[model samples]
Target: MAYWLMKSEPYEYSWSQLVADGRNVWTGVRNYQAANNLRAMQVGDRAFFYHSNEGREIVGVMEIAKTAYPDPTDETARFVAVEVTPLMAAVTPVTLAAVKADPRLVDFSLVRQSRLSVAPVRDGEWAMLCEMAGISA
Candidate 1:
């Protein structure tokens, strides 16, 4: 399965909130590239729940419960969204600093395209990140 990293602002939608909600539509992606990434997602694919802006860390894991669909939050219908559910919280939150320092993750999309809200994660990078987060890949 393909892997991904999806960012969410803590104030807007925190990892704790996702756990509490159980599952929710991942929406509000206005960037074409990010929307395309969302469209690429498939049901059962796993994503790292990166808490951007505030925490700047990957706090948990989530599974794509539903594939891409028309985003109800969008007025023009140009964007799409997927449904994600909490899989498990990281035992050790992986910070941006930690990620940047890791030589193995030098080419990771999260490092290369820092502003991208949704980004693809390579298989090797995914495994390394899971290791850093103290979780099984």
Candidate 2:
């Protein structure tokens, strides 16, 4: 399955919120490229639930529960949203600092496209990050 990194500001919606809610619709993506990333996702695919802005760390894992669908929150209907369910919390959150310091992750989309809220994650990168977070890939 495809892997992805989905970012949300801690104040807006944190990993703890997802765990409490059980699941949520990942929406409000207005960027074309990020929309495309959402469109490319499928049920069962995994994603890193990253806390951007304040925390700047991957706090947990989530899995797509539904494929792309017209986002209910998008009035323009130009974007799509995927249903996601919390999978597991990181034993140790992988901070952006750690990610940046790792030379092997130089090409990681999260580093290259810092402004992108949703980004693709290569299989190897996913495994490495999971390992660093003390979780199974």
Tens-place lDDT digits, model 2, residues 1-137: 99999999999999999999999999888999999999999889999999999999999999999999999999998899999999999999999999999999999999999999999999999999999999999
Report lDDT per candidate. 0.96, 0.96
lDDT of 1 at 33: 97
Tens digits of per-residue lDDT, candidate 1, 1-137, equal: 99999999999999999999999999999999999999999999999999999989999999999999999999999999999999999999999999999998999999999999999999999999999999998
Which ranges in model 1 have alpha carbons more than 4 Å from their true place?
A: none
Residue 31 local lDDT, model 1: 97
| Candidate 2 backbone overlaps, count | 0
Model 1 shows how many backbone clashes?
Answer: 0
- Cα deviation in Å at residue 93, candidate 2? 0.4
